[model samples]
Target chain A: MTLSVALGPDTQEGTRTGTAEATDSLTAPDIPWNLVIWNDPVNLMSYVSYVFQSYFGYSESKANKLMMEVHRKGRSIVAHGSKEQVERHAVAMHGFGLWATVEKASGGPGGNSGKSGGPGQGKGKRG
Target chain B: MLQPEERAGQDPLAALIGLDMDVAEPTDRAVKRLLPNVVKDDGAASLEFRQLTERSLRETKIGALRAAALDLDKDEIVLTPEGAKHWSMALNDVRLVLAERLDIRDEEDAEHVHLMQDWSQAEDVESYLALVYNFATWLQESLVQAMLQSLETRR
Candidate 1:
């Protein structure tokens, strides 16, 4: 029912006949994919943030924010997108020596995604 | 605190969330060779050994604690059979290693080994060396325990 906005021919707004399957396969179901990083003992907190900084090119504050989420909340979803994007982030985290994994996001989890919502607001459910 | 259980074919923490604490393994040759000597039944010996073991886990100061990892699976950390044995035996390892290094009199020190009151005086260089050894042991034990606990949590 909702129209997908497109800037050019590549988007083919109305000519959706051929690409429906492609799009459906590309995007996981209603559930969003997430990259989750678990806390570990060997690596230092600062070091984890530093790796996030160096690998993602995120600023120190941003990296620390994600790292804090992981430390305080037990785990945090560092990235989200299609399955491949989440997988890439998971791999990068592992290469950096942080514990990470991927899983399908739950529907209506009744919590903030940690962006607009504060802590205890968008709590990622423990499974 | 108890070590979190690690389930088969899953991340140790999540699957084994409620299982019994699985002990870690021993890696040092000396620790293995010397475990039997630890006075397992003595309350003071367990306390002294635990203090050093916890300390070792916190800090990698002990040469042997650094080397004595059971094994690491995925992200969950657990002690192996050998590791648990090592942990259980470490008290003896500490006693003997420090006893030899400190030149502690077999008779006098043996009777006083796990007693804090005995070392309060620090009457000789040997006693001082015992204190140092105790410190290193504490660092290693603390780190291992801390690592095991944190990793077992979902974090």
Candidate 2:
């Protein structure tokens, strides 16, 4: 499913700025989207880690770290790549019943610049 | 909770529906986990969202669970795309409820569940719930794999 949501004008502008910032990064400019999973009361910590490992093929320790980050910080950027790839990850996470979203790799409101904010901040959306 | 022979019988679907009904009834822990507040800081908006969506969401899940149970009773257990989605969500709901009831909060708790030997050796409520939790997890994992396989074929 192509999950789309309408954003306010200001939010849209912010997303553009964030996308630009992501593109300007030195290490890699092609990967400008992130797949983020948010913390929720329903999913178990271990289960989340297991999903990360099984789906993404991350090492156990790395999956555990990402799961812990989501648990402690309310969200974690699980993957970063092009829009299509990130959306695929988001959809897979949703298939596992995780609250996931694809957002531009830029910062979001509430002082959550691209690096810190949870998944849906750029679009203020969900999948 | 089901034996190998029993799993092949029609009773499995009935048992699954029974379990779904039990889960659908209001229980404090289940309710909190299944219909968690989306907006944490705003009490008013949270309450409003729950009131508006909770009932429908619960009903949808229940319906899906029941449908999946019926589907399992068929000769082939084939799942349509919509059935796949519903079954996945229903299986997740079951896991979430089982996890909450079992107090599976973190890695240690989940590891303890994994360490359990057998349901026949279950000495207490926690042990019994651990078995259920593990079974639900297995079920969900299998369904997820099946869904992924189908996605791969479509691609």
Local distance difference test scores for all models: 0.42, 0.57
Full-model lDDT, candidate 1: 0.42
The DockQ figures for the candidates are: 0.01, 0.09
TM-score of chain B of each: 0.30, 0.73
- Residue B134 in model 2: lDDT: 71
Error of 2 at B42 (Å): 1.8
Pairs of residues at least 3 apart in sequence or in different chains that clash in candidate 2: A106-A114, A107-A113, A107-A114
Tens digits of per-residue lDDT for model 2, A87-121:
55654564456777555666422122334445444
Q: Please give, for residues B3-33, the per-residue lDDT of candidate 1 as tens digits.
A: 2233576544423332222223334433322
| Cα lDDT of model 2 by residue, B1-155, tens digit | 11112233354554543322212223476555555443434444345434334444555666777888898778887778778777777777777677677776665666676667597889899888877767766665566556554544664
